[model samples]
Every structure is written in structure tokens, then in C-alpha cells.
Target: MSAAPLTLTVATPLRVWFDAVEIVSLRAEDASGSFGIRPGHADCVTLLAPSVVRWTCTDGTTRYCAVDGGVLLVSRGVRISIACREAISGDSLESLEAGVRSRHAEEDDAARRARVEQLQLHARAVRQMLRYLRPHPGGGADGPDGPGIGANPR
Candidate 1:
């Protein structure tokens, strides 16, 4: 079967990358619960969480990305615009993995650390919603007061 085409727009620091690819899966929050969108989905808008987004290339290569928090707009023709705090492209999985590791190593001072802590709280709430909406591979939903999605959930 031919793969369905979708537009993915990623916004980051001072730049936005737009690409057309085959959308493998999309998970977002709706009023009812978390919902997944595939090809030919209805046009809608919803809040997104800090979670992994997976997609497949025409060559059957699957890629993964991490989205912090954002708004997702999906149109009938598979056009999606994601206005997110951060989006890590799935291309070059090794490089992406390494980048994530390097990013985690940087430590901020007191004030910045406080702000990050606050953001982490918000991210955690989003993650919980995601879990409730769509449970991940091997676990139950996180507690309400659990750490943020990207934070150390200890």
C-alpha cells in the first residue's frame, strides 16, 4: 500500500522545519481523552504533551521524536502544524540520541534551575494526561504529582 502523506512543521529556536512524510502515528489530547490520528483524519486542533512521536518514511524507516509541549493542528489531507516548545527531529537517530545526552549534562544555576523545575512540573502533568490518554508500552499511568515527562521521575 502506498503511504499517506502528511506535513510536519517543527518550530524551534529561530527556525522552523517543514517536511512532508508518511505519518505513522499521532497521539494528542482531546476533550474525551487521548486520541490517535492516522491518514485521512478529520481536521482538528489539540494540546500536545511531552512524549515520543513516531513516523515512518516512504522507505519503511521508522523514526522517533521527542516533543516537549505544543499545539497540534491536523487537517483532512494529513497536514499538521505543531507549535511546540521543542521538537527533536528523528533523523539520524544516533546523533539525536547523542544530542539528548549532551543536553542533559548541562546544569543551570539557582534561578534558572527554579524555572526549569516549574516547567518540569508542567511537563509531568502533560505526561500524565498522555498516559491516561494513551498508555505507553510497559507501564501504568503515572501518579498525578509525578515528575515531569523529561525530568528524573524519582
Candidate 2:
């Protein structure tokens, strides 16, 4: 007799990506490495990195999901749950990979822009502070006796 299939549920903060679907097996990656899950496997929890998760259904067709890091929990040796910040699913690995790369590129660009903006803000703040500290253009001491030893103009 064939082993019972496991149920998979994937979700993000916004919505449920995949409801309970019966899958014969599953493959995912974590910091340690890739691992597989099947019915009657040990109940465990793992931290998944940004990688593709693949599973084979009872019909013998495979499906894929790209996750941006998440937590995977296996319960009762038959229930698999994945919670991620972002996830995209497709049957074609090539398309899935392309989509992931595009998403990552957009995120990187946004981060770079944010950093630039933050640096600009800091620069502006420093410039303002320096301007405030500087002596008045026409009134402040231009000679040593006025403000400091070097303030004296020859």
C-alpha cells in the first residue's frame, strides 16, 4: 500500500498563498541545506532561506514556490505549514526563477534609493548645524582678540 500524502499550506502576511493541498513529497532549502518531507516523517520545524520549494502531488505533477525566507512547521508527520513574508508559485521552474530575480532586483533598488535619501538627509542636517555654528558673516570676530587666537587678521 502507498503511504498517505501530506497536506501543505503556504501563507504570507497578506493572504493565504496555498490552501491545504495533498502532496506526495516536498523539497525545501534552509541555511543547512535542502531537505525533503513525506508522510510519516518526523514532526519538526525549520527556518527556510530564500529558495524554491517544490512538491510532487499525488497525480505525479510537480509545483514550485519561491519564498523570501520563512518558517516551516511540520505537524503530526502529515501537515506542513509555511509562513513567509513573500511567496510566488508556478509550475515552471524557469519562470519562477526569473520572477524571483526580478523581485529581488526591485527590492535592491528600493533599498539603495532609501539609503541615498537617508544619507542626503544626514548631509543636510550636518550642513545646517555647521551654518548655525559659524560666526555671522559681517559681525562675528574676524580678529584673534574677537573670538580665538587665530581670529586676528594680519
TM value for model 1: 0.54
Which 10 successive residues of model 2 have the least lDDT summed? 143-152
lDDT of 2 by residue, 68-93 (tens): 89999999999999999999898889
Clashing pairs in 2: 143-151, 143-152, 144-151, 144-152
lDDT tens per residue, model 1, 1-154? 8547666666756568545555556555544556767778789877777765656654667776666767788887588777777767657667677666555555345568889999999999998677655534444434466543444344
- Candidate 2, position 83, lDDT: 99
Candidate 2: stretches off by over 4 Å: 1-3, 141-154
Report the number of the highest-lDDT candidate: 2
TM-score of each: 0.54, 0.76
Candidate 2 is scored at a TM of 0.76
All models, RMSD in angstroms: 21.1, 4.6
Local distance difference test, per candidate? 0.66, 0.89
